[model samples]
Target: MYINPEQLSSYAAKFINLLIDYSPKLISAFLVLFVGLYAIKFINRIIRKIMEKRNLDPTLTKFLADILLWALRILLFVTFISNLGIETSSFVAILGAMGLAVGLSLQGSLSNFAGGMLIIVFKPFKVGDTIEAQGVIATVLEIQIFVTKMLTGNNQTVFVPNGALSNGTIINYSMQGERRADLTFSVSYDSDIKKAKDILLEVLNKNPKVLQKPAPEVFVKNLSASSVDFAVRPWAKNANYGAVFSETLEDCKTALDQAGISVQPFTLQK
Candidate 1:
């Protein structure tokens, strides 16, 4: 440890020179990073407002805003690195390769994400809609990035993957504003067909939930080995479908009982 003062001073000078040369670039990079982050936030806010003004779906709005924010951040990251005199081509290439690998590993998740995007864009169904898909009939609670959350009639929460939902057949009962309730009531073969039909029609007409425009219809649908089946078709607003259906069935049974008609127990077929 017998270093000369001249050599020590030379090392100190070189260190100070290096710091001096890099300080401005470092400061500029930090400044760019901070400003870029603020700009991204401001841009995201503006975009959200625009989407709201256009009355876009809330789910779509959030998804699009997040995607844009991340994209801008990535670009800003590249700029920040380049300002520090670091080459970014290799960095971007690495990012691309990583993204590709992640994408390949998450094929199903990516499919679901794509499906969610399509649902948001096309709007085959929306929140609060009664949709039947994949053998589940439930009200849509939330349309997320990879799955659609639903509330079943029995208070069960179901998550349906958006990939299968978008590709499969979706029956949106609420989209039409009105739904036709198809009810089948079975009675003894000895019951008077005309009397039973009239009684069912009367019950539908009296019910406030049933729509009067489309009118209700009751007809002999089939004759089983021991019972007669009557198809009762009634139309009601989408919101009142469940009420109308259940109420009509109960009222019809009561009416038949009062009219000396024996109702046969029937099992509902999905």
Candidate 2:
């Protein structure tokens, strides 16, 4: 049972050589990992600043940057792990399967996200904008990936999905510098159309909020079965719209009353 001491010593030296050979590879892998992570953070910070400078929507900007940075960092870490002699293909495959399952589950959410991306890029509307969409009228509060939040005149919050919002007609009332108000209060056909028009014109003229560039126009709109329909088109600033609408309606009633115009009540069928 006598063994060669030299052979035993040679085997021990071989073991030391192997360990020495693997040490640099291990260090290199760690170096790459740290460097990749730092790079991701640096790049993400730069992107965030650029987005802020460009006046991008804060919520969208942060969400996208975070997702991108984390994605890149995970990919780099996977590569680094592979460099360290670890199997990573199966991990990636599992992640891909989970992503597919998640995608299927979030079909509606994906549609909203896609729509929100389009909105952020195209800038159809933003917070504080008064827009009409899906038959709902409100001021935009925040535009989220899945939904656009709005505050109604009654101070109620309304959440409209981006998918439905993007698909439907969005009437941006604030886009135009001036809005032409349409106020209709029918009078008896026996009432003189000329007199009504004159009275409306007078009221519009006295109003300072009404735009003078495009003069107020009052004309016979339609001949109804029981009343003479008169259309009054008065241009006013977008901000003055609500108040002007109310005041003009009152002014119109006053003018009609002073001019001896008679309003017919709705008749009920017995």
**Against the unseen true structure, what C-alpha lDDT does each candidate score?**
0.92, 0.84
**Candidate 1 minimal-lDDT segment of 10 residues:** 261-270
Tens-place lDDT digits, model 2, residues 1-270: 998999999999999998899888799899998899789989999999999999878867876897798789888978898888878888789878999999999999999988887877777787778999988999998887688999999999999999889888898878766888886767898888888888888899899999888888888777778988777778899999887787888888887888799855641111
Q: Cα RMSD for candidate 1? A: 2.7
Report how far residue 137 has shifted in candidate 1, in Å.
2.1
TM-score of each: 0.89, 0.76
Clashing pairs in 1: none
Off by over 4 Å in 2: 1-45, 55-73, 76-86, 266-270
lDDT of 2: 0.84
> How many clashing residue pairs, candidate 2?
0
Using lDDT as the measure, the top candidate is: 1
Candidate topping TM-score: 1
Scored by lDDT, model 1 comes in at 0.92
